[model samples]
Target chain A: MIPIILFLAPALAMALFIFRSKKLNAVVICLYSFTHLACSVTLLVHPASYGRYFQVEPLNLFFLVVLSVVLAGISVYNADFTLKSAVPARKSTYYSAAVLVFSAAISGVVLGANLGMMWVCLETTTITGAYLIYYKTGKEPLEAAWKYMFICSIGIAFAFVGLIFLSLAFTGSQPSLFFTDINAHAPVFNKFWLKMSFVFMAIGFGTKAGLAPVHTWLPDAYSEAPSPVSALLSAALLNSELLIIIRILKIMKIADLGGFASAFLITMGVLSVFVAAVYIIRVGNYKRMLAYSSIENMGLITISAAIGGPAAFAAVLHIAAHAFSKASLFMTSGNILKRYYTREINGVTGLLKADPKAGWSWIAGFILLCGIPPSPIFLSEFIMIRTMFGRGMWWLAVPVMLLVTIVIYGMASTMFKMSFGNPQKGISQERFNILNYAGQFVFIAVLCLLGIYMPKAISDLITAAASLM
Target chain B: MTEVLIAIFGITMLYVSSTSRVEAYIRVLAVQGVILFLMVLLDHAHLEVLNLVFLGAETLLFKAIIIPVFLMFTVRKNNIQREAEPFMPSFYSVLITTAIFAFGFLIAFWASSNASNVRPLYFGVSIATIITGLFIIISRKKIITHVMGYIMIENGIFMLAMSVVGEMPMIVNLGVLLDLFAAIYLLGLFVTKINSTFDELHIDSLTNLRD
Candidate 1:
């Protein structure tokens, strides 16, 4: 029942976006975010089901909380981000509406108990997200939106084929599309079709998760979108995609094909990390650099998920930790973009002199992303490597660690070049809004506190989520 | 009867690949939707009246009527160039699609040899159509043609779902159809905007965003 409000909140907001004056755009967005945060918290505290099609299980519970938290932060930032913009009022109005729909689609993806429902919501994200990317109405945004939507649509089509294959595995009276039903009966399913289904779904859902080879659109789309949207894309959208994969992985485990699923995920994970390591070095666009870092983080989480057990605990923690850390970085990047008016790494320097607050946030975001101590990423990477060694996956562990180190440098060099230099002459000296920093400040603080100490409730939630995986 | 309709559905992709005219692709989609409607009607004859009506509305009104109409409207409104300007020649495209069809046939025969539950023909044709749709998307230079390829893949998915012995709920089917409509409408809107922005549906002008 509470899940219905998550869906309804967006509808209400969309109504306000259409009927009300533009002034209410921020208020409507803020209201919806509050509604979103409220519903997810209630749902987590008191698990509820919306018929058989939507349920708040341990796995999605963790992802839902992460998404709501990220949305809450992005909403606050977006309210200010829209206040003064090069973007016209009409365009920003549509942008606000699209963001609402995008967040709702993601929540739908996370809440769906039925795989079909999840797939629908997943595709909805592609549509809404494409519009959000194209909000500025120009060449680059169009191209980015086109590539993102077209590629993801095809990926989604393949996933539907996978769903068909899943039905093929059931030879009896009726095939079920519900996740729990599939999980319950997977042991008796046909092995050949099960493997085939897994293959197609991995490629299908993996594409959306920005897993490598199929991840060609991630950099462009992430780099091209406005910073608030980028934060949502990096923090919320990708998690929903990975959550689907996690659900599929659980099904694979139930069928005693955990070995196959684990190998497949690890291979994809390393490829994603390697792609980041290769591409991040050559990127001149700071936003694209951040985009590559996102891919690498996603790869790390995937590897941890594949490793299972306590490593899966690390995976869940890293997902939450990375969500906050990355969102803050992207939001801070917005601040830098507004002042400098360029995305190129060489376009602006002396970020510290220009806006010390943003500059420090950027540095702090880099440190958190690089997995230094007091960042949960450090703990996750440590556990991931120790577990890989414990499992005698030396070959996998060593290369992933090396590639990740390279990725860290790729981001760090870009960060230092921008953060420490003199603020470029002739930069815009527009009055900076304190509200612009609201989201990033809260995100950084929460991330730092979590890194220092994990509350029992959150850790228990993480453990429960991991056990399901 | 359904098998015959399914085979015709697979053959439609061959036409899709062989043609240079984008309108023909849209026409083929309309034909495939009609084919799908017929197949669903024949298959679900015994379903409840409510389910039957909804399914009919889905494949007929939504799939057959709405999509192709909007697509044709988009093409005409944009005055898009009729030529698909595919990356490869039509000859190679035809050959590749044929090869894909043969492979699908082979897989259908091989996998279902021991299983009575397999509807080999539908499985083969749907798989073949899906791959061919993907081929069209990658090979074609026009964004409109790419959309046609997407719709083609969607038709293949509908056929694939129909092939299964047990049925997915009508609600899921309705959801897919609705989502497909939304996707097409948005894509069409973008295509129009893209046409105006770059002055054509050419993919070449979209090269600015690369790393």
Candidate 2:
């Protein structure tokens, strides 16, 4: 029942947009967000009651919570942001509808019990998100939207091929697409087909996860999109894609092919970090830099998952922490963009003087993202490094740490320069509504609070989700 | 009979690689769709009425009719140039595609010798088609050509899926069909948008957002 409502609320909101009332659009979006959050909480509390097709397991519960929190925050921010933006009414309605649809698609991805259903939901996100990226109605945004749609479509098409290969692994059996059934039957499956399937799935979903080699579209799409949409792309969409990859890893584990899969993940993970380091150091666009940072963090998560055991637990924690921190950072970047009217790093200075709240939030979010003290990413990175050393892979740890340090320095230098300098003379100093800052505040508060204290229930949930992987 | 049809399907990709015209690409796609429809009919004699109907609609209507016609509509609407302007010359593309086809045959022969459960010819042609499609995408400069290449890839995947026809659930088939239609629809729409936004439909113009 909850799952049904969760799926329907966004559809209802999208339908409401046809009436073209901006006020109603805001009302419906907020209503949908609160309802979604409520459903996530209820589902988290009683995950077993859901139907088989959309069951809320511990792993999905954590993702659902993260998504719901981010959605709630974004919705609040969007209400204020949309009101002030110069977009026409019709486009705003479309934007509002697309946002709802995007959220619903992500929720569907998290809640989907079958791989096929998850794939469908994931593709839906690409479509809806393409619209959001194209919201600015410019040549560049159009290119971003086109590349995003076309490349992701190709990537996902390959993933579908991967799914076909996966089915081929079930030779002479009652073929099933359900995750539980696949896991149960994995050991007896054809190893060659399974390996082939994993390769395709990795490339296919890896494109969406913004893994290196297939991550060409990520920076462009992120930089070109509206900030809130960027937040959703980095925070929720990437996590959902990773969730599929994690499920594949679980199947690999059951088939005694965990080592093989882990090797590939680690290779891609290291490559992603290396790629992020290369680009982050010289990136001209701040949003593109944030996009690169996302790639780096995703790489770390992949590396953590590859290390398995305690590192897997850290991977889950890092996912949650990164979501909040990155969302806040992206939202704050929105504030910066609003004030400065430019995405170029060189264009803005004295952020602290121009807008103290956004400036501080930017610094805080960057620090949190950089894995400074108490940030869950710091703990996650520590555990991952320990795992590497424990496994006698100190060689791998050295480059990873080096690359991470480079990325940190690159991001921090730019951030500090932007945050503390004298304001550029001609830029207008318009005050933003408090509501615009509300989401970032919530995200930062959560990130900071979690860094210092982990409530027992949240810790238990993270542990349970990790153990599943 | 199915083998001959599959071979023809594989040969279509060669023609596609050698050609530089957008209309030729669409024609190739339509021909492949028809061949696929025939292959399905010949291979799945035991399929239920509903399944047969679904396959017929998928192959004949959507793939052969709707997609090509819709693409042609987009092409006409945009008044796109006739020449595709490949990154590489036609001769090289043809030579490379031939080499790929030979490689596919080699793979098929090897897998047949190894007693693999997969039908070697199906695996070989599908893999070659997929590779050729990717090559087309990479070598082509125009967005429409890229889309055509993507369709080729979809056709290859469909061929592979046909190899294990009854084993997969119906829902997977439905999902695949949905994805295909949606992807094609969206790609076509974007082509029009790109036409209007940029002076030309060349993909090089899309480099504005890069770092």
Give, for candidate 1 chain B, the lowest lDDT window spanning 10 residues.
B165-174
Model 1, A271-356: lDDT tens digits are: 99999999998899998998988889889999999989879998999999889999999999889999999999999799998999
lDDT of each: 0.85, 0.87
Q: Can you write out model 2's per-residue Cα lDDT over A235-327, one digit (the tens) per residue? A: 999999999999999999999999999999999999999999999999999999999999999999999998899998999999999888999
Q: What is the TM-score of chain A alone in each candidate?
A: 0.98, 0.98
The reply for model 1, stretches above 4 Å from the true place, is A86-91, B169-176
- What range of 10 consecutive residues in model 2 chain A has the weakest lDDT sum? A1-10
Q: Candidate 1 on B67-149: residue-level lDDT in tens?
A: 88988888888898889998888999999999999998888887688456677898899889988988998898888887888
Q: What is residue A52's positional error in candidate 2, in angstroms?
A: 2.6
Q: Which window of 10 residues has the lowest lDDT sum in candidate 1 chain A?
A: A1-10
